[model samples]
Target: MGRQEKVTTSLAGTVGEEIGAFLAPVDAALERDYPGDPGTRQPVHTVYVPGDVFGAGTVRSWGDRALAALDEHAPDAAAFAAVLGLDGALAEAVYARVRTKLEREPVEDLRVDFEDGYGSRPDAEEDAAAARAARLIAQAYEDGTAAPYMGIRMKCLEAAVRDRGIRTLDVFLSGLAEAGGLPDGLVLTLPKVTYPEQVTAMVRLLEAFEKARGLAPGRIGFEIQIETSQAVLAADGTATVARLIRAAEGRATGLHYGTFDYSACLGVSAAHQASDHPAADHAKAVMQVAAAGTGVRLSDGSTNVLPVGPTGQVHDAWRLHYGLTRRALARAYYQGWDMHPGHLPTRYAAVFAFYREGFERTAARLARYVHRVGGDVMDEPATAKALSGHLLRGLDCGALDLAEVTGATGLTRAELDGLATPRRGGGAT
Candidate 1:
């Protein structure tokens, strides 16, 4: 008998009874199969402007002046559109004006300006301020025509906000809920996440808010900014990340690599270092490995330094800035923040390169694995040893166009199918 028949006959008696019982439940599951159609994948780049960008202070003033200048210089909608289209030198000028205005406001003022003076909701004014802040955030979403995935960096939940008690957490979440339904796929940037319990507390608060709103449980998501030494130095960094992921459970969507905070944690003195500093890269690798296949996106923190001057090789400066940005993107992380419009192209290019390379590499490896192994299993350890070479070869070549690679390599559909299937051994067959 052939191998298939031999195996079937060996299981024909007692095993057949177990198989029949298993098949009985199988039909019920098959009948209710809800094989949903695959949805289109959205583009991954998200440009973040500080939430304070539109509050009633220097940021708001700068925005008003910039808008007025745009109106005066380019009155028509087309001119307005042209200004929006500005990048490199022209874009830098507009961004600088806005940045200057935003920087003028003391960080203390911005923090205190939040409704209710941190934790205490003394009266109606605080409530009104909270409502206004929420409205401004919503309006910014509408005005900027921001990417579908938007997030805000809020003041940390702390002793001041907590009133030296746990009630502060509830008050802040309540304020957010009262302001509006959680922003689309909310990402609360929790600064100074030192312990797992802190993450758990935030999750509990989000859960309470969702239940009260009658929203689906776990609808809100969060991303932690890993800025503290304690966060990075936790016993088994991987375990720490895994713990954070579990705390948010269904709600955690991303983990942002906080370069500046991390450097400070390490006591690095150099101020001009970029996000890709060797030390930062090592920390990010830990995050990337932990987050792999979790469906939780990873983002590198922003390039803190912005280019100065309105003219003279501004594009070159932007390119250099982008080169750092691209390195982050190439590392297989999905998102990064753009502090200015000039950084937009770099973000886009890096994203395009990542997807293009990842798809091509996966495809090519599958193609070659099928060619070598055919439909049979490699049983001998010695025979199985060199099979990894095929995968490494494809990865080494970087990205390629799927159609072109398939055509050039002459791999057939049946072989491709075998390659796609997992083998008994861990590596692709």
Candidate 2:
């Protein structure tokens, strides 16, 4: 035989020290179907309210108001379903379910903002608001309607506003502790983060609060808001999402994008600033890439085009919100901010329809792939993950039942349960 050329690859040249350590955990995370806590139910949208009007009963009140508005504005599920391109029969089912879901529990997460939502206020007023918020927290727990996820959004740590932000946070935390300590699933949101030091400082402050308030260590976590060009890219043109999260020192649970503010940073005009804007897409893409397997959640910004004002515009606005919500879903951005109560209907509609419209078809395909059936069908690990993701997401959010998923996927209950989980230590099926 003729002599063959020798082929050798240099591992060090291919992957440096940093890449190796990063990949180690990433590979382990990928072995599972989903990263982070699968039991953690990520709300479809976060409802933001100003600080003054926020009280323990606020969420319940909002649910009632939202339901009333939904009935008046979007009474028929069939109509909204048509707007989303859902099948007539399936659309009705989703509509009916969503109506009940909203009536029962409308807000999954609430943010009492001391930032733009509340605007500037006197210290006494701010303190009063904080106390009210604390009472609300306690009330929510007692009533059993407290959202599974809830938090307060303080103003940025900028020099001018940092003191007020700190004061508000301190007052709120103190009141919350005095009332009944921090509740489960509570987080503090730090917005417009431009430097890693901001995160480090906030973490230190939280630690101090935990100690003073007699709360468990690390009981409070914060979500970073990526709203500036600086957040998307450092001065050296490197992505800063991972750095920002690391600066949190293990307390950063989620990173949320702010659409209008981010767009303004890019100098995009008001008319051009949108959820699907190129600049917004690029920034969020950087966030997704950096935070991919780290288990730090990512949320897209809100759509400012609200469904209020005129009768004609309301319908147009609803359709626009759904389109934007669907756009986020397509990019795997499951969570976004809903600025208005009206946005709630479209948010749930888009999410339910996304999972429901193709539930049976996707499940059947997955079943075929899992069973190794051949009929011009092809599947990969990613395909399995996608199918499992929908089923699990639906289940977690109350959109799909175990029976429905099992029946559709043709898998036993045990196998069905594991569908959403990453198939670890097993050969590819």
Candidate 3:
């Protein structure tokens, strides 16, 4: 069999066995203790926050000032747009108009991403400064004053580092380690990851580090940024992403869409295209398909065009634009990202609305399915198999919660235990 066929065959067998085993119940006590409601478990959405948002000088003060500004304007659409790197005048006008009706809603996770080559590129002085900046940010988290969960993006491995025969990547990661234990979880955003071997190589280095630090072997997790054209066009793109996730195994956390880079790879003009552009949607779909249900989370890229317009019209335009993108992401099951405080309310509003809507629809479907598949114990393997997969998916997406799902579906905790099992079949569900 060819590689694709081989992969397909292997996946089918694996998924089938897993489903069968998972449906079989565990000890009654174990079922009660598991936190997942199966029916009502919603996907967690992580929001990405840019590291460089705090101005270049006097980092703490800059951060404080930015926070203050966000506090004042986050609820206002225009103000939020302005803080998101949009023009100032226009952002203010929008803030004035939308400030009254907004509420405070913040997601749990916030990611701080480093600029390209902060660690990997040449320039001794520049790299040192970058290291210092990273340390400062990590220190902020260590102080326990930042978000509850925080993550950092590391530089991707580059050709120059490879050519020099210097373990530049190692040196950079070492600096981060010295700064502090990994930040909540490290998001090693690998760019241009075209092959599985690249992921394995990074994994080897992480393993070495884990041993040196006496940390558990699989403690560090990663989030791959599928940016390059080559990565998207790879013969086994989904499989490649899966391999990357497996490299981290217990450590793999999530995957992020790189809108600009992926667009560039497609030979599409990057100018004026927002993160929610049609091209971006296509890219996100590919990523979603690749990450369907192995439990690894997925994130959509940022809206590049910060909304900056005078009058409520400008701010409204910006909100509508961002709202569309936010809607798209929530539709695809992504959580959150690095947004200005001003944008927080919108992010919260959009995400909450999406989940509320999804839950309602999914709940109905699962309720119907359970009723259709009544409790009669069956002997036919194929008939049992089809019903099992359908029920499992319904439970996974919060369609069935403990109280409602268990009572209505007649699927005991024992039957739901297998829902978390990784299926080699597809991506994040």
Prediction 3 TM-score vs. true: 0.59
Residue-level lDDT for 108 in candidate 2: 82
Candidate 1 structure lDDT:
0.49
What TM-score, computed on C-alpha atoms, does each candidate reach?
0.58, 0.87, 0.59
Worst ten in a row by lDDT for model 2: 31-40
Alpha carbon lDDT of residue 174, candidate 1?
59
Candidate 1 lDDT by residue in tens digits, 399-423: 2333554664455433433343323
* Top of the candidates by lDDT: 2
lDDT of 2 by residue, 93-159 (tens): 7887778778777888899989999999888988888778877877787679888788799988999
lDDT of each: 0.49, 0.81, 0.50
Clashes of each: 0, 3, 22
Residue pairs in clash, model 1:
none
Candidate 1 — which residues are off by over 4 angstroms? 1-5, 8-48, 55-130, 137-146, 160-180, 183-185, 235-238, 353-429
For each of the candidates, the C-alpha root-mean-square deviation to the true structure, in angstroms, is 11.4, 5.5, 11.7
Candidate 3, 15-71: lDDT as tens digits: 977976786566332333222222323333444444444222332332343344445
Better of 1 and 3 by lDDT: 3
